[model samples]
Each structure stands twice: as structure tokens, then as C-alpha cells.
Target: MTRVRHWPTLAVLAVALALPHFTRGTQTEFAIEVMITGMFALSLNILIGRLGLISFGHGLFLGVGAYLAGFMLRHLSENLFLLLAAALIVGMLVSALVGAMVLRLGGVGFVMITIAFCQLFYVLVLSTQTWSGGINGIPSIPRPKLWRGTDLPAWLSLDSEFTFYYVALVGLVLLVYGLKRLDASPLGSVFSGIRQNAARMRALGYPVRRFQLIGFVMAGSLAAVAGALHASLFGLVDPSLLFWTTSGEVILMVILGGVGVLYGPLVGAALFLALFHYLGTLTDHWRLVLGIVFVVVVLYAPNGLVPLVTNALGRWRGAKPSARGAAVALPEDAT
Candidate 1:
């Protein structure tokens, strides 16, 4: 029964793995972007959906990863593993430092502090034009090699669009799987407790702030990984990647897909990218149309499109919504 229940997720994974073969030209690139962005959204959702923390400056971590990767590739080696490791380490360290200060605040204060940090990084990057390329941005970053100083098969090279797509798809799958496991563990229970009732969790002797800090660091690290992938994909890093607006865009993706649902980020990223790509081609004022559609979705599907669709499917199949599993449900509110 458990295996049967996971068929949908497996099918989605299969489709993602096969996407590059079916897509051509810009569509292939767009699909890669979708996967990367989905990863970023998922990371952010860990804090927003599980911990009830809304960060308006998550893009700072993403930018950090991108710049770090770009700098390493430009000055050091093109080994993909090394780039990601460097990015992850730097991301965690930065997140730890920032989280220490920001996690002490709650609600709107937290949000504002995050945004402030993001903007500060943006300005710093711009000011350091010698390394960051200033307003023009760094460009022509070489694609990651399969392995540095090793003669590998050409197919394994990330320089190819098809190869990179699969690499990104695999990364996304791993991220989703790992996060799901985390969400089902005892630690996830504590995260939910904190989200639903911090007072109760504190009363129960849990280190609520510590948990929140850990979540923040984990999310930041993953976001950085996504950023490194993004930099590798585009061969560029820019201050805009660290801007507050970039974080806002990620937040929108999470909300549009359905916060707290395991697959929400994937659905949301696909939808958001599809709208931006297809609509922008048809009209100069695509933002207006996009905004209208977003408003409509939010007004109708308050919890998010993922939950709405899952509930509808559950009814059609003659199963209670709860039978779908904890992955689809919102974290329980403490009584």
C-alpha cells in the first residue's frame, strides 16, 4: 500500500528525468531553471511552512552560493563537487552568523531583519566591483566539468543541456526526499510544535530558538546549493540575485504552490515559470496578467493549489484526505 501510494511522486520524477529529451532549445533551459527554482522554493518552505518563519531575504544565501561558486570556478577548479561543497560550507557559516542575530526576533521584525541582511549583501556585492563585476555582473563562467583533471566520457559533462538537466533533476529529487524524511522525524514534530505554539514547545522544555536556528541554517545551505547550480547553469553571478525582490519571488512561488505540502514547491515553480515564460512572449504587460492570475488563485485556493488539488483527488478516489499522508497536511496546531 505504501508503495502504491507513492506512484504519483515516482511518476513525477520519471517525467522530470525525461523532460530534457522532449524539450528543445529554450524550453530545455527553462526546464532546468524550473528545477533549480523549485529546489530554492523547497528550501524556503522548510522555514515558512514548518517553522512559521517568513524570510524576506533568503536570496542573500542564494547569492552567496552563486558568487562563491563563480569565484571558485574562475580562480580555482571546475569540479562540481568542490564547488557545491564550498558553497554549502560558506552558506552554513553565513547562515549561522545571521541566524544567531535574526532568530531572536519574531513576526514582522524577523521579516524586516532578513530583508535588511539581503540588501546589505546586495550593496556589498555592488561595491566590490573588482570581484563581483559591479552593476554589469560576472559573465562567461565556464560550465562545471564532470571531474577536474580526469578524462571522462563526454556525455557526463555538465556542459551539455541534457546532462545538466538530469543532474539538476537528481538534485531536486534528493532534496525533496531528504526534506520529507526530516519532516516525518521527531525533530519535525518539534518544528511543528514550535510553529503551532512556541509557548507550549518552550513549556515542554524544547529549545525552540535553537531548533529555529537550525532550520534557518539548513534552509540557507540548501538555498546556497541551488544558487551554485544556478550560477553554473548561467555562468554568471550578479547583485540582483541577492536582492530582496529575488527573495520575494521565491516566497510567492512557495505560497502559490501550497505551503507545507511536500510537492508544493515543484508545482509552484512550474506554474510560476510557465506563466512568466509563456505570458511574457504574448504581451509586454505580462506582469499585470500574472498578478491578476495570482490574486485569483490566492482568493480561491487559500491554502494553496496543491492542497486543493489533492483534496479533490482524494474525494474522487473515495479516500479521506487524511489518508493521503502527512506530507499533504498542514502541521498540526497544538491544543
Candidate 2:
């Protein structure tokens, strides 16, 4: 019965698995970007959907992973495992420090502090030319190999774009699966409780800050993983990747995708990337169209595109509206 309920997810996965077979060159690259963006947005959603907190500087974590990965690839080695592990570990450390200081603030204050942290790193990158490549950013980062100076077979290397696509897809799938399990765990309940009433949770003696930091670390580490993948994808890491606008774009992704639903980021990323790629080909002012669409979503469907689309589909099927990103709904196993 549960399997019957998840047909759509399975169908989507089937399509993703077969994506490379159907598309070539730019289209395949675009699909890769979509998966990467989806994971990036999913990282931000960890805080937004689960904790009901928004961090404007979340891109800082992405940048950290990207820059560090680029550095490691350039000066260290192309070992895939080492690069990813380094990125994730550094992201965890940085986010732990940031969360410890900023998680104490609530609402707007928290958002502002996060933005401040992001910008601090942004300017620091600009000023430190020897380390981060300054405004020029790091370029021509190498793809991941199995390990440095190891006799491992080349099949383990991620040199082929076709190979990396599967890797990205697998990473995104694992992240979603992990988050779903997290939702079903006791920790998820505490997060849900904190979302409803932090004060009540605190009264019950739950160490709210610790849990928030854990979520932050999880999201940060994943963002780093996304960043490392991105570095390999383009062989470049731009300073703008750390910009506040990057965070804003991710936040928009979360809002456009249903906030609470685990798979919503993939949907939103596909739409956003399609619009971005197609509209940019037509005109330079593509952001204007995005801005208009964002305003429409905000003014009309504040609950997000998922609920609207799902509710319409549900009406045809005579099922109830999916409680994706709804503030009041008790979060289910996934959403």
C-alpha cells in the first residue's frame, strides 16, 4: 500500500536514471545542473521547512565547500573521496561555529547575522587573492579520481560527464532518503515540536540550540558536497557563488518548490533552470521574468507551487490536497 502511494516518486526516479540515454551535450549538462541545484535548495530547506527558520547567508556554506574543494583539487589531489570528505567536514566545522553564535538569535536577527557572515566571507575572498583567487575566483578545477597515487581502476574515477551525472543523481537521492528517515526519527519530532513552539520544547527540557546546530551542520555539509560537485562540473569556482544573491536564489527555490516536501526542490529546480536557460537565450533580461513569477507566487500561492499543482491534480483524482509546506499540518514522514 505504501509502495502504491509513492508511484510518482518512483516514476521520477526512473526518468532521472534514464536521463542520459535521452539527452545529449547541453541538455545532459542542464540535467546535471538541475540535480545540483535541487540538492543546493534542499540544503536550505532543512532549516526553512523543518525549523521554520530562514537563513539569508546559507550560500556561505555552499561557497565554503566550493572554494575549499577547488583549492584541494588545485593544490592537493583529485581524489574524489578525499575532496568530498574534506568539503563536508569543513562545512560542518564552519556551520557549527556559525550556528553556535547565530542560532541564539531568533527571526530577523538570525537572518541578518547569517547575511553578515556570508558577506564577511565574500569580502574576505575578494581581498585574499592568493587563497581564493580573489574576484577572479578559482578556475579549471580537476574532476575527482579514486585516490591520489593509488593503483585503483580508472572505473572509479569521475572523469566522464556521464559518470558524474549518475553520481549527482545518487547524492541527491541519498540526501532525500536520509531526510525522510530523519523526519520519521525522534529528532524530527523534536524539530517539528520546535517549529510549532520552541518555548514549549524548551520548557520540556529539550536542548533546542543543539538540535538547531545539528540541522545546520547537516545542511551545511550537504551544501559543501553540492559545492564540490559544482567545482568538478564547471572546473571553476566564482566568488559570486558566495554572494547573498546566491542565497536568495536558493530561498526562492524553496519557496517555489513546496517548502516542506522532500522532493519539491527537484521540481522547482527543473522549472527554474528551464526558464533560466530558455529565457536567457531569448533575452538578457531573464531575471525580470523570474522576478515577476516570484511576485506572483508570493502574492497568490504563498503555500507554494507544489500544493497548488498537487491540489489541482488531487481534485481530479478525488484525493485530498497534499499538505506540503503548510504551516499547520503535522509533518508527515517526508514533508
Candidate 3:
């Protein structure tokens, strides 16, 4: 029974693992992009779904990680792990500072303040041409080295799309597994409590705001990791990452996938990207089609596609009893 409950996710993971074997290398870029985007969306989910905080500038941290990583790779170190550590540290610091400043504001105020902070960084980057490369962004961004040693390992190289795709894919898997475990942890219970009733949590002596900050910092830091992956994937760090629209896209992904569900954002990112990829070639006004689809999903399937599909399938199956149950129907009579 426990296995039955988990089989869907396991099935999806199996498909993900087997994808590269079945698909062409050309599809590797798309797979990597989906994994990265899914990570970003899920990170934001920690805020919107669990913490009940809607940030409009989550991408600010992403930009920070990307630009910092690009700068480090070009001028300092090529070690990927080192760059990731740097990104994580910088993201935590920046998110903590920003969270401290804006977390006091609730509802719309928090959203507005976040936008302001992101804009500030955006303009700051745009103004510093030598530092951030201004509006043009940091070009020729180098890929990080897997190791800092003289001889490279037998099994690591970011230059190969095949290798990097699996790297990011494995990362996504681990993230989902960790988050699933976290969902069952005491901290997750606290987060769920806070989401349900912040005032009640405060009455119980839980530092609600502090928890929110922790969640914010955690989300932002994870987002920065996603940004680093994005930079590595494209070999460029751009101003578009910090743009408000980028945050909006993640919001869309969460909505499309289903907020509050761990794997929802991933499914959402995949679906959203599918639309963007397929709809894009069909017409220049692809966004219009995408918007319509989004609206349809929101109106008809408010819980997002995952739950909707799952429940619908459950109902269809439930409507028909299995023959095995009938074969054992001595049930009430036997008792």
C-alpha cells in the first residue's frame, strides 16, 4: 500500500532517468532548462506555499548568484563546488538582509518592498558597466571546473551536455527527495502551522517572523543555486534574470504545477516550458496562447494539473470496483 502511494513519483523518476537513453542529445538543453526552472519554482514554493509569503523579486538572488559565479569563474576560480558555495553564502547574506528589512511588512507591502529591492539591484547592475557589464550582461561566461586538481576525473565534465544534464537531473532528484523528507519533519510541521495560523503560532511562543525569515533565506539561497546552474547552462549571465518578469514566470510555474505540493512546481515548469517551446514555433504571439491555457487551467483546475489529473484518475478507478474484491466478497457475511 505504501508502495502504491509512491509509485507515481517513482514512475516519473524512472522516466526522467531513462529519458537521455531514449532521446537525442538535442533534447539535453531542454531537459537541463526544465530541471533548472523546476528548481527555481520549487524554491519559491517554500515561500508561497509553506510560508505564505509571495515574493515578486525572487530572481534578485538568482542574478546575484549568476553574476557572482560568472565573475569568479572568469577571474578567480574554476571549481564548480567553490562557486556553488560562494553563491550559497552570498544568497543567504543578501536574502537575510532583505528579509530583515521587508519581512515586517505583510501582504502587499512585502510584495512591493521585494520588488523595490530587486529593482535597486537591477539598476545598480545596469549602472555599473565595468562591474556587471551593464545592460549587455556578462558575456563569455565560463563553465566551472568539477575539480581543482591537475588531472581531471574520469567521470566529470560540464562541457558535455550529456554529463551536465545528468548532473542537474540527479540534483533535481535529490532536492525532491530531501524536500519530501522535510515535509514530514518537525520543521515542516511548524511551517505548515505558520501557514495555517501565524497568530496561533505566535501564541504558542513560536517565533513566526523568525521562521519566515529562515524560510525566505532558504528559498533565496536555493534560488541562487538555480541561477548558478542557469548561468553555467547558457554560459552567460544576463540582466533578464533579475527582471520582474522572471519572478512572474516562476509564479506562473507554481500556479501551473500546483502550489503546496512538492512535485507540483516541477510538473508546472515542464508544462510551461512545453508550451513555450511548442507554442513559440507556431506563432510570434505565443504568450497569448500560453495565457489562454493558463487561464483555462486556473479556472477549471485550481489545484493545478497534477492534483486534478490524480483525482480524476482516482475517481475513474473508484467508480469501478475490482473483480478481485468481488471474488473475496465473503467480507461482511464471514465476519
Which candidate number has the best TM-score? 1
Query: Considering summed lDDT, which 10 consecutive residues are worst modelled in model 1?
Result: 326-335
lDDT of 1 by residue, 14-57 (tens): 88777787899788889999999999999999888889888999
Candidate 2 stretches greater than 4 Å from native = 147-155, 324-335
Tens-digit lDDT track for model 3 on 1-335? 99997797789889988887776765878999999999999899888877778889998988998998889988998787888888889999999999999898887788888898888899999999988999999989877768776577645658777778788998788788878887799998888788777878889999988998989999999899889889988889999899888888898998887877777899899988988898888988989988998999889987777767766776688854322111101111100
The lDDT leader among the candidates is 1
Clashes of each: 0, 0, 0
Supply the global lDDT for candidate 1.
0.86
CA lDDT of each candidate? 0.86, 0.84, 0.83
Residues 142-214, candidate 2, lDDT per residue (tens digit)? 7888656666665676666678789888888998999999989999898888777777788899888888888
Query: Which residue pairs come into collision in candidate 1?
Result: none
Worst 10 residues of 3 by lDDT: 326-335
Query: What TM-score does structure 2 among the candidates reach?
Result: 0.93
Candidate 2 vs candidate 3: which has greater TM-score?
2
> Which stretches in model 3 have alpha-carbon errors above 4 Å?
149-155, 319-335
Ranking by lDDT: 1, 2, 3
lDDT of 2 at 169: 88
